[model samples]
Target: MDVSIIETSSLGDRSYLISAGAVGVVVDPQRDIDRVLALARDRGVRITHVLETHIHNDYVTGGLELARTVGAEYVVPAGDDVGYQRRAVGDGDLIDASPILLQVMHTPGHTHHHVSYVLRESNGGIRGVFTGGSMLFGTTGRTDLLGKEHTEELTHAQYHSVRRLAVELPADTKVYPTHGFGSFCAATPASGDSSTVGEQRTTNPALTQDEQSYVDELIAGLSEYPAYYAHMGVINTRGPAPVDLSLPAPVDPDELRRRIEDGEWVVDLRERTAFAAGHLGGTLGFELSDSFVTYLGWLYQWGAPLTLIGENEDQVADARRELVRIGIDDLAGAAVGEIHTLVAGTELRSYRVADFAALSEALREKDTTVLDVRQRNEYAESHIDGAINIPLHELADHLGTLPDGEIWVHCASGYRASIAASMIDRPGRTTVLINDDYDNANDTDITSAT
Candidate 1:
């Protein structure tokens, strides 16, 4: 049996296609089922089962639709209160999928009913375990996602869940997790790219630290996740509609301007530098990239009529796929063409993009107002001295309170800063994007840590 990893880097998550002979089983698929279908087709394998580790709290799961498309059995843990029909599995249940056999292990940490599937050969030789959200690369899934009231209890459960996997599974069993590549689902940033049960024994915090210590540290390290996560569980539980990857109907410049004037979301999918150079006044610059979906979903007003302003049709199409992964379907329309043409006689808004070196030099000549758009915890760890900490997500509500002058915006990387700079740019304010890494700030004498 071979395990094929299907990575969705935007959400920092992975889905797996475990195949033996002509049969395959998919675990934790994203909303875009075409990717999984294409993979199965390429491998010449028929999908026999689609298993969801839990009702996901990040992206909408494609498991239900994928199963329906291929006539595969949809398997979910027994205790989740879901709306759809499926094969409800519980702990100690053995699944026979041809040459591949799976044993269910009740791992109640990430969620109350989360389960990990132990993959084995027909002869009972353990190959690996899919520990979704429970045991990640180095840390575990954050316990506060369900709510703060359950954090402590879930943290305790998370500690034991990791311990249970370590003690019960063979030392060499491969570890496959659904979250923690870069997802906020992780309690902390996961380390490295891959690990095994044996490797985790030496490096995983839950394995090395005492249970109480593990729980305490995990809870203490928890930080803010995206606001969009609140809607993911609800959408996943109710069963998400089949995704619409078709391009949104073309929107004319007149209508695009009308939508922007009427206060609808008109997201611009272009490179950060290009967006900084020129963009529509009210359009958000979410540059089509890996981080685009996470930040866009975090700040997006749920259920709002969203329109796309892309440089080309392909860019808008790509953005649509990313948006659908998080359940942002039903795009109002999309306007694609040169920014100048799409402006419809309205002048394009522009901003200056610079690096930390420019910031350091500017500080020498004048008292510059710097805005750090990173998370509060990140700001506490280290930031430029006197830089205002209005995280990008909070910038919209607090934009009016920002001190006047040329506001220099920055984040750990230029991504959030570019977004913030676009939001803060207006009639009289001078917005400069610090398009550089925050570590570069340390090269000067402007950085400080608490």
Candidate 2:
């Protein structure tokens, strides 16, 4: 029997393949089927079992596609609501594969329905456990994602779930968690791609915290979530399965422009701050700082031809990679040259911002509209009076509500304001950037973007 850990960092995901007796099992594979396929083909092994620890939210999984290609059994928890073929395995259920044994563990916290699998070598009897998002090396699941009604109950449940794994599972059991460093799944890693149960018991910080404090801290620290979380679970539960991934041809700017003019939805893949500044009128804006790839799949329709306006040419490839992860394949290419030319025919104008004193004077004169694009905490901490707060993270959805007047955007620094200023696309709406960290300047303008 042989075990291999596939580091699928491209999608910012990690999965494992266990092979024995001519049959291999793949756990939580990423959207790139070719990588998984190539690895199996090279090893002269065929995938016969596809195990999804849970319905993932961070990125789409290639589990179903890989299963279809290999004629494997796709398995998930009965509680797992997903759109593809899957056999539900509950706690204590086991699958035998000559030299490998897998036992299912129900660990719900990251989502209402999630699972982990404990695997063992037939000869040694027990070797390791595959913990999906529910349990990472040293951290535990964040209970805030569950609906507000279940928040308290789930938080307590998560505490017990961690307790169960830490107390009941064998100390010698090697741990293979779903994600590692840089993944949103877990912040702290005790050691290695794997850990021993005993080691985690003594070292994992999550386990050391008393149940209540652990829950509060974890929930409180969660960043402003992606703009698309609520609809994702439902979509994954019943939406049409993701289409096959075949990289789209690179589109020329002229072709992209034609598509834009032809009524296809154009996406501005810069950060919210950038998009709010000034961009092609009517383009859907999502900043690269947020979860652009995941929300790209959620907010936009699939099969929709996508034209992009990014910070640079290099980001075009990065944007494409993320869109492809969830099977969104249509491309109309990127915005080239000064974006102003594209909006020249439209009324979307650009405005700039200066220091609070300058902004105050402008407010008195009523020359421009001020947009505060900082977090709620930052906005409450200290901000310019009379400035309307529409956090940069929520800019995409809330932009429609703002008055389409001369729009001046500002964040903590000039960098964010420059990005925020780009979202103004109406011919009449002039967008401007404010150097919020200004040491001397009183105001800044959209032209400040370089």
Candidate 3:
């Protein structure tokens, strides 16, 4: 049997293509089906089945369309009322695809109806387990995405679900999880990508603790998830549009300006230094990185038209892929050109980037308001003495609460701070970005608060 792990770095989600002989099966596929299809063609295998562990709340799934396109069986969990045609599967159900036999295990924690598929040979020898969000590398999936009301209950379920896997599966069985590796869906940060059932039983924190203790720990560790996540489950249930790889229409400078004037967002996908040097006035600087889709989806208004500005066509294409994952597909057009040339006569905006040492000195000269854009839990743990807490996701809504003066913005690292600076930076109001490593703040002479 052969299994290919396709990692979506932008969202930190993994999909698998498992095959034996000329038949293959896809598990937890993303919206982009081209890559999966190409892999099948390259391997000279026909995709016989598409399986979804649960209704994903992080990104749209292309499983339905992929299955339809390939003339394969679309298997989904029976717990969800996904108004669509599919082979609804439940616990103890067995699926046969030649040499690969999948046994469904109902694991409810990430969702009420989540299931993990245990792969075995025709002779019943355990090979691997596709433990979607139930079991991760060093932790389990966060149970709070559903809502606060379901948090405790789901966490309790997660404890039992993980325990069941450890007891039922062999120690050497490989565990493949969908959420981990920088995904916020994880209960805690994962140490690595893959882990065996034996490793998890010995090292996983959730596995070691009792049900109540595990529930408390999991609930307390969850930070603010993306706002766009709210719509994903519903969208996945209804099914999403087929992946459209065509590039968005190209817009010249005049059209870009016109859209900006019409209250449409002009997102500049460039590095922080390049964005900080000189960018179009009122153009939001969102660096094209793993966190691009996260912040953009959080800040951007739903259904609003957006014009993308990138250094080149490739950068814009990358940004489009990330945007589509979060259901932000209302792309008006894209502007691909040099920043200076595009905004010729207009005055470009820039902010001063400083270190913690500079921030300490600046605070001495005048009373400066420092804005800490980390999550609430992070802020609660420790922060600069006088800094105000306004998580980056909620910064736009709390702009009015900011006191007048030189505002010092920062996050764990420089990434989020750079984004915050671009949002709150103005013509007259000076905003200094403390772009240094957050750990360095602890060494500074400046007092800190918990």
User: Best by TM-score, which number?
Assistant: 1
Which residue pairs show collisions in model 3?
none
Model 3: lDDT equals: 0.87
| Consecutive 10-residue window with the lowest summed lDDT within model 2 | 441-450
Better of 2 and 3 by TM-score: 3
Say which candidate scores most in lDDT. 1
Candidate 2, after superposition: displacement of residue 228 in Å? 2.9
Instruction: Score candidate 2 by lDDT.
Output: 0.66
The better candidate by lDDT, 1 or 2, is 1
Alpha-carbon error at 248 in model 2, in Å? 4.5
- Clashes, model 3: 0
Residue 136 C-alpha lDDT in model 3:
90
Per-residue alpha-carbon lDDT of candidate 1 for residues 325-347, written as tens digits (9 for 90 to 100): 99999899999898899988899
Q: Give one digit per residue, the lDDT tens place, for model 2 in 156-244.
A: 77777767788878899888877654455553333455678788787665578887787787666665544344544554567335454
Q: List the candidates ranked by lDDT, beginning with the highest.
A: 1, 3, 2
Model 2's number of clashes is 41
Off by over 4 Å in 3: 447-449
Clashes of each: 0, 41, 0
lDDT scores of the candidates, listed in order: 0.92, 0.66, 0.87
